[model samples]
Each structure stands twice: as structure tokens, then as C-alpha cells.
Target: MWSAPTTTAALLTHVVRGAEEAGYNGLMVALTRNADASAQLNELSEEWTSVHDVTGQLIAVLSPDPEVRTAKIRYPIVYECAAMHDLRLVPPEDHDFGFNRCFVGSVHGDQLRGRAEAVPPRPPQEHRNAWTEAASRCASYFGITEAQIPAVLLLSFAERTAVLIRLRPRSADSLYDLCKQVAADLGWTKRAAELSARQRALRQRQHHLHRVVDRPELSRAKWRSRSADRLGSRMTDELRAQYDGLDRHLSSIAEVNPALVQQWRARLAELRSHGTVEETYRQLFAIRRHVIAPQDRQKWRRLAAKVGKVIAATDRVILGRYTQFWNLDDADPITAELRRQEAEMGRQGAEMDRTATEARQELRQIDDELNSVAAELGDIKPKHDSEPGLAAATEAAARHMLGQIDTDTVDGSAGLAGYTVRVVRPMAEAPVEHIDNSLSGTVFGPMVQAGHIAGGVHIHQHGLWARMRRWFS
Candidate 1:
């Protein structure tokens, strides 16, 4: 309960007995209610100077000063005085244990006049009265009773003693700066009419605290600045670390998966007519092995096992160490570029693998074929010029033999207009030599206009065999 805000002083016994019953450390004063107790306070008064604003109030004895910490002192001590009475004691200076600073004094005032001597070191009763009135006015505007004020009041960081409120002594000002800034403009109304710049600054700080934390395009690095120290820096640090970690993962993936052949499968087709995607694919295509899934079923019976059906495809592929960096919300240039490069890298990496694999397989086949033909030719026996001869045949018989051995025919019906389709077949026993399509050229002379043939229409050349062992086996 609050004592009435009377200008008159509270009785000595009420202040001492009330504060002491609440376990105040004024041991000598609490033990004696006689004239001796007042004398003792008068004696110890030098060690702790009274803050004159409410110097005579029941609460004034409580000190929040570091040198004389009285934080354990609670107000409205329980008493058997069913005189139906109660009183609350408030300290002029609330003590600090761990909270951070609320403000700083003026640079010039801090340098020129120390906080203790900023005003008359020991303000006379008249000055105390004036300050008490100013504090009451300040409290009234804040919708708080003087008793409810949490920390010492201040004008501003730059102007410590410019106003009537001050809670720290100059000797201990540097030692005790950590006052929680719960209410900033407690006693700043001293120059409220003229200090436009200070008012703007205070308003700006208040507004800065209302920052958007979850916005997508927070590209500005303001959070890293010291100005943002009180504006949720700890949360920003954690979020930034997560983004960096995800970035590293994507960068690593990009490095290994660099762009290769754009559409390698399509390229291979425009090389192949081609295709596989992994180990089974390699076996099916590379080694030409049948890649069949297992089916455990009874032989020729209605007990055939059925393959399980896939009702729906999965919505997402598993990713490595995912975080907000993988989300589309971060539209910053750096993140977007990384995403593009990584996607391209994946495509190229896949194509390069397929193209390289096919090239290796085709080259192996070529090398084996070359070696086989060379070895077979090396094993051929030489023929003699004076070999035993059969009876000489007629030119007509020779021509007839040539007709069967080297045949050429044309089907004009199936050919294009003004052109005939020429077909040639060499006897199976004959060795491959240069093919002659001259008969068609002669038949169509100037009729067969411009033309181009990409390799052979059909490779009927023979004698070379057993290319790669892998192909057959």
C-alpha cells in the first residue's frame, strides 16, 4: 500500500521499524526505538547519503547503489499493527545486478563535470524539493506512481544532468552503468519543447525495433552492423548460419556436377538412334546382358506371382541437409545464380557420363575387330602362280560365272520418277572389295540429279568377324 504523497516527512520510527522488519541491514537502528536509534542513523548517514527527492519517505532508506545494495529490501512490510495501516518504501536509486545500460550521459558533461559534481554534490533541501516535484510530474505522465518506477530516470545519454532526475553518483558512475532501459524518457521532458534533434533520434530508435524478421528479400547487411546490436542480432546470426551451410552444400554439388553435353541422351541418339540410366542399364547396354526383374512363380500354373503396382509417384526426391536456402523465397542474386549453375551442372554431369560410357564401348569394339581381321589375314596361306589348272573354260562360260558371282538388277517400278532402284549382291564366298554403284549412274546418266548419302544405305561388306568378345558372350 502507498503512503499518501505528502510533502511532510514520515516519522523516524515508521521508516526504521518498517524497513528493518522487512530485514533491512540498518541493524543498530532496527534494535533501538529510542533517541539512541536516531543518533545512530545520524552517525552512519555519512556512509550513505540520502537522495533528497523522497529523502524522508518510508522507502528512502532502501539503496540500489552498488556500494550499498539494498535490493532485498521489499516494500509494505507485514506488521501486527492492526492499526489497519501499511506503508511502501521505494529507493530513489534502484540497484543493478545484471541488466544492460539504459543510456549514457552527455560527452561534454561527462568530460567537464563528473556525475557527482554535475549538480551541487549534496543538494540542499530546496533543490531536493524541486527535483521531487519534477519526478512526480514525470511519473504522472508515464501512468506510473513514483513508487512503481523500476530504474533510475535520465534526460538522455548525452545530457545526464540536464534534467532533474539522476540516480548514479559520479564516483560510481563508470562502475554501475548497467541499468535496464525499461522506460527511456523518464525525465527527458526538461528540454522537450526545444530539443527537436534528440526527440527525432529517440523516435527513430523506437521505430527501428519494429523491424520485419521474416521478410524474404532481406539482402541489406544492416543486421551485421553494430547499430543492430539491440535489434535481435542473436536470431539473425542463427538464420545466417543456416543459410551459409545450405549454400556450401549446393556449391559443392555444383562443383562436381558441372555442365556437360546438354541433352546427352538426345545427343547420343543423334550419335545412337540411343540409352540406360545405371548398373542394370550398364549390363543391358554395355555388356548386352538381359536385365530382368525377379519373379518367383510356380511353373505353368495359375499361381503366377504378380508384381506390386505403383499407385502414385513420389512427390519429392530426398535432398542433402536442406534448409531455407533451398526455398524459392530468397530472391537475391547470389542465391539465384548458385541455383542456376547447380541445375546446369547436374544436367551436364549426367550427359557426360552417358556419352563417355558409349564412346568407350564403341572404341573397344573397333579395336577388337581390327585386331581380329589382322590376325586372320596373317594366318592365310599364299597361293602359287603355276597352280594345277582345270580345263580352260569358254568366254561365254566365264561371263555366265561372272553373272552369278556379281549380280546387279534394277526395279524401276519401285524407284522414284525418272530414277531406278539399283540392287547389287556379291556371292557369299567372295571377299569384300570396293562396291560399284556405277550401273545405276550409267542408267540414270544425267537423270539422277544432285544427291548425298550418309555412310552406306546397308553395310553388306563381309569377311571381317568376331568383333568384341563381349558382344557375343
Candidate 2:
């Protein structure tokens, strides 16, 4: 049987209270790889949040045992951590939202540790007020109004930026209105602009839209010239020279025949159409090495040998090619080398085929063993539902899985307000140096109802999604 709720009463009470106050009354499951963590320090922020976890909480939380109960997470802080995740985390097994779980713990892939635990706590009113004052001071020092403060404020002291997440579960107005209201609530009035933006000094842009321009479309011949220019740019000088020589020599020989001229042009166009110029040249070069070069060597040998047939054939031939090119002598040295290489390739291919066959047979045997084990273990129902440890094991094996320490972890014993004295410290004389303050944030309106907060922490308010964008960044 599981232990009583008092073990985590303080952890549970704080998160549910904070989340409800923020209008996130929905049930949530918190998982972590923090098997040894009770508090998570943002390493960068040096912010300490307290955490409470049962030894093996993940499976225990999802267990269907009657003794199992819901474990509310530490709020606000965990949500900030969650926002860092690009995708939502769902455990391998279906969640028992009806208090079927009692614990949570560490998980690596599908493997579950002993039990589950959660972390986090929100900043209290006074700390919240202190944060507001600091932000106001930053805006004033910079000579900008509260509405003009960037979405992200990078202080001079801390290595990490201070992202202000104002969760106004109570307000429904534009982000601009919320900023103005926030300033008013803080007893300050200094807003220089309407919206947040990240300015970039260097950017590429299209030519002037209204001006007329003179430009002619390229013809096929122009494309061919363009191809040569591109080839020189892409390849080394020696390679381009070698290719140019080949093209000139081939053109001189092929000029004698109209058919040869057409064939050469078509080949050049095809080679130029795709891939790098060096790669295309290699295809033509390989044909010369493996085919043409050997033939020329044999012709030279035969001519030196004073063979009547070779001399007579040369007189009749058009530049020793343009027809005699495909005519192979079978005795070419490259031909002999290719035959030897083919025999070696055949043996390697046969060995690969045998290994593939053996692998297929081994896979079949493994499949049979797996089916046998699955049939035997399928009968156990209680283990699947009662024990989170087993469910984590089986579900992990099935597929998928793992999340954050929560708010209470941040609050520890002190409230969120007491957590930090002053978060907005300026560098030198500048109020805040914004690294990037673009409006790239994706805003989501109330996923749940918004009546939870009667009046907002600010006048017009922001919600969870906005809070995520602020803190997660």
C-alpha cells in the first residue's frame, strides 16, 4: 500500500493553489530525469525552487490501485520549464486523470526509477511588487515608458536575461493595453512606443518595388556560357584547364561530321544541366581512361610495328575517331583490369548475400521468441494497473515517453516575492540592453475559463502562453 498524502501535502497544496489562481485548474502530470533532485536551480538564474518527490513517483502516479491518488505539481515555475519543451510530454501509458496515480520519479527513455516527485512555487505579492518596481526603474533609467520595455530584458549583472511573465488570468486586452495598465498599476507613466520589436542592422532585401528595370532573359547559348563560368568558379584551375583541353580536342575531331557535332553539343548540355562541373567532367574522363585511352595506345603500337592494316585504316579514318571510337581491340590493358575487378566484386557480392540470408533467419527466430514471451505475460492485468513501476516497464517496452520540477521548488519555504530582492540590474548606465525583442511569440487565448482571477495582477493581463514565451526564452 502507498503512504498517506501528508508526505506531499505542502507540495500539492501550493501548486494547485497557484495554478488555480492562474486559471490552470486542469490536472497535470510532471515527470523528470531528476532521480536525485528535490530542488532545481536554473544554474543560470541561481533561482532555487524546492521539490518533493516519492522515490518512484512516475509509475506510482499512474497506478490504478485504490491507494493511488492524484499528485498536483508545483505551479508557475514548472510551467516555465514546460514552455522550453517544443512538444507536450505524454507518458507511455494512458494518464488516469481521476487520481489513479500516487507518485512520480526519474525516467530515462522507457526505464523508470523508484517513485515520482514534483517541484516549483510561484513568487508572492511583495516579491512580485519588488519585481515590478525593478522593471519600472529599468524603463525609467533608459528613458523609455513601461509600454516600451522590450519583451525580454537582459540585465547587466546576471548572465541570463530576466524574462517577466505576467500571468493576467483575469484580463482580456491587447498586449499593448496590458503594458500601459501595468505601468499605471505601478504608479508610473512612461510608454514611448506601441509594440515590441527586435531591430537588425544587417539584412538582405529585394530591389526597389516602384522603379522599372532593364534585364533580358538568358538564351540556351547564354546558359551554355553561364555553365562554363560556373564550372571555373566551382573547380580548381588545373581541372578546368584539363576539361577545356578535352572539349577543344573533341570539338576539332567532331567538326568533320554534322552528326558528331550534334552528339557533342547534346552531351555538353546534359553534363551542364546537373550536379557540380567536376563531377560531370569525371564521367567523361572515366570513359576516356577505361575506353578511349587504351584504343589510342594500341593504334600507336600497331603504327610503330609498321602493320599494313593499321596504316591503311588510319588513312581511311576521320581523325582516328568519329566512328572508330567504339571499336574496341579487346586486348586493351584497361579491359583486362576491369575483368579482374569484376571477378573480385562478384565474390564480395556473394558473401554479402549469404550474410543477409543469415540475418533474416536470426530475425525470424527472435520474433518467434518475442511472440512466445508476449503470450505468456499478456495474462497479468493487476501489474499493469496497480503498480506504476511495472506499468512504466511495460509501457516503456511498448513505446514512447518523460517533464519538470515545479513552482514550490522555486518558492521553497519563502514566497516567490521574497525569492529575489531586485532582478533588474543595469549595465554601466543603460537601463536594459535587449539582445532580441522580436514579436515571434505565439499567443494562445484561455484554454480554460478565465474567471479564476477576479482582478488581474496587472490592469489588462497576459495569460499562460504569453508567460511561456517570456520565461522559456
For residues 217-287, could you state the per-residue lDDT of candidate 1 as single tens digits? 21224212322232122224433343234334334433233342123222322321111111111211221
Model 2 C-alpha lDDT per residue in residues 1-473, reported as the tens digit of each score: 01112122223333323222222111122111121111211210122111122111111111111111222454222332332232233222224532212112111111111112232122233222223323333334223334423222211111111122221122221222222232232221111110000001001011211111211222234334433443424444434444455455445555345585456546655654544443443344343443235345343332212222222232122111111222234445334434544565466657755655665565555556555544544544433334322212222221210111111112112222222211221222336766653345576664323444565555444788789888989
How much lDDT does each candidate structure score? Answer: 0.25, 0.29
| Error in Å for residue 290 of model 1 | 41
**Ten residues in sequence with the least summed lDDT for candidate 2:** 193-202
Which residue runs of candidate 1 sit more than 4 Å off their true CA positions? 1-239, 242-473
